[model samples]
Target: MTAAAPSATMRLIEASTMISQGAEAKIYRARLHPPAASSPSDPSAPDGCVLLKHRFAKQYRHPTLDGALTRARVAGEARALVRCLRAGVRVPGVRMVDAAAGVLGIEWVDGASVRALLGGGAEGEVEVEERDDGEEEEGEEEAHEDGAEVALREYGLTPDQVMEMIGAELAKMHRADVVHGDLTTSNMMLRRPSAAQPAAELVLIDFGLAYISTLPEDKAVDLYVLERAFASTHPQSEPLFAGVLNAYAKGMGKDWTPVSRRLDDVRLRGRKRSMVG
Candidate 1:
């Protein structure tokens, strides 16, 4: 299926700031409409700020078929977000959807991705201002420039605390029976603490690959996916991941044992596949 570019979409793109792009979609930091006054406006006022994910239309398929599939996928993501929200899982609220144009707009999260916070490279981060030519780019090394401890202190967090948040949040999401098919630190954000909201909250983003599943196997795989992501993204991350699992287990209550056993099995399969490849 294919979608003819809408003029409105083009205008939105022109006014919005593109933050990242993937094979499936392009993300933008955009406001639904212009600020009431260009001069100055209330910071607390709702400006319809959103993180827009625009799914590119497939050109290989018939227009009718592609349009239907695109709409279904967009709707699926929105439904998943709603499910997570109802289950008390922290996630961006769906703001608007234009299935015909394959666009899904969600609440703008004001913070940094967990990966960036944990010293993972921020390849597509949106910065508030451009640094001067002499400034160094912030990355894994930059995050730890002073010291890991000092870094965490700046954010009022410890490595273990972040891990616990990750694990508990995943369990909450799983309890709601929503499988985040692609679980990674980059997909999780740490909302900056403010005077109004003193506690930093973790918010899950990107439901493009999320789906509903009651199966324990799916949940286990979700954990396994995150495990690998942690291993590859952070140094000496095994202990951190273990902490996450512990928190996850506690959050799961009676639902932990089965998923834990399944996770072990998934890990074994992953090892075997790696050796085979």
Candidate 2:
């Protein structure tokens, strides 16, 4: 879907910081403080922050079709996120939804994208940790002089652990019947829970291409796509992907057998279904 460039009319009022931009949407970190309800007991929600994803219209597509497509995707993404949240999966909560304007606002999560966390060659200080004073702490590690290989070390996770998180999260998503059509590390994020919490949280984001599916083949294809992504991006990915599947299998329990076999067949035939006569 083609979305138009962001408009001031549609722009989020309190989005003071621009986080990232891609072909389809622009992400902004913003605070959303809605008016208090009639009840005095309803305490004001102070500085309720969120991520505003504005799906800008694409100039490439016809105007009529573009608007319709953009609106649909925005709505779909918001719905998918809500579905995952209700299923006990770790996804940002939907703070607001404006389907007509092609905007899906979600709770702003403080964390690093799985891509940035894994491919850590980024230059400059990174906001890796938060302090008690409400300031983000920068990573003090020196930049890798090797360039490309530097970022790989920033993830703080071994390849095996990364794979396990991927596997377990995907299994939960699939079991809940959510199919993330784009299953890449870039779409996931790793965030440390609040100071009260210890273990890190794996959050699945960007559900623009997500849908609900119960088919074993669909689930298998999701894993296949992720496996290919890891192999292409990271060196020595076999063991890593194996670890992912181990976690997935454990999460899927009895439902994993069929999907595992299907994945093996998919690997042999390649990502596409054969169209031969």
Candidate 3:
């Protein structure tokens, strides 16, 4: 198959609306598939909206090398998402890929980031909509609106339950030998369940730093990062994190022993480094 040239049609980019920008890529809300106005019966066509991640040009690097680097990264991210999907991890599905332009489109998850849902402010904190002055101001909201209390009412789950889901998902991913190099609450989402799915699901996102690895140490480090994230963002959830590990251990089944030991080692090393610094 002939690969699309660097100048290939970038209608996908043209249709996208930039939503947020991070160090590695600019994200946009876009439609991957052209409207099936002619053939609504097309079985291969996917959803209307998609999230596009574009790794823009870097002026510092030489043009040829930069283009190659960008393409490699886009491919890597797409591969990671596919790997998670096969492993039954609730990651957004990839819809389109334009490696030449360093753009990768994925399913647009329609729900709140776990960060915002947990009172961790928001992931990017970009204000998109304006509220009326008559609307309740920020301070007027009850204290229960702070964290998981609202989740209990809306999602019917508490912080502990969400933590368990996070742990189980991480376990499943690690069991599939995919180590998420960056595991943080901000990198997860709570997809609101629909007719297809009955209950809300915890979905891990931003797999830009993910890689395949079978090593227990790598998985342990991943768990360690998740632990620190919980401690920092939802301090009250720290105690319940043991329950998360128990859930993870149950999910891991026979593979839990070694990862558990390695996690202990990682925590010790982390404390030592903190003390030294």
For lDDT, the strongest prediction is 1
lDDT of each: 0.82, 0.73, 0.80
Write the number of the candidate with greater lDDT, choosing between 1 and 2. 1
Candidate 1 per-residue lDDT, tens place, 29-112, comes to: 888866776524643333557888988877888989988988999999999999999999999998888877888889988887
- Each model's RMSD to truth, in Å? 6.7, 10.1, 6.8
Give the TM-score of each candidate.
Answer: 0.84, 0.74, 0.83
Please identify which of the two predictions, 1 or 2, would achieve the higher TM-score against the true structure.
Answer: 1
Off by over 4 Å in 2: 1-15, 34-47, 120-159, 271-277
List ranges where model 3 is wrong by over 4 Å: 1-9, 34-47, 123-146
Ranked candidates, highest TM-score first: 1, 3, 2
- Give a tens-digit lDDT track for model 2, residues 1-277: 8987666536564334676788888887666655345424322222356778878788999989999998889888988898898888888899888877778888766666766655432323332343798553443222321332343344445546767887888888999999999987777887754555456677888899998889888899899888887665543334557888899999999999999898898887784444542
- Cα shift from native, residue 202, model 3 (Å): 1.4
Identify the superior model by lDDT, candidate 1 or candidate 3: 1
Q: Candidate 1: lDDT of 71?
A: 93
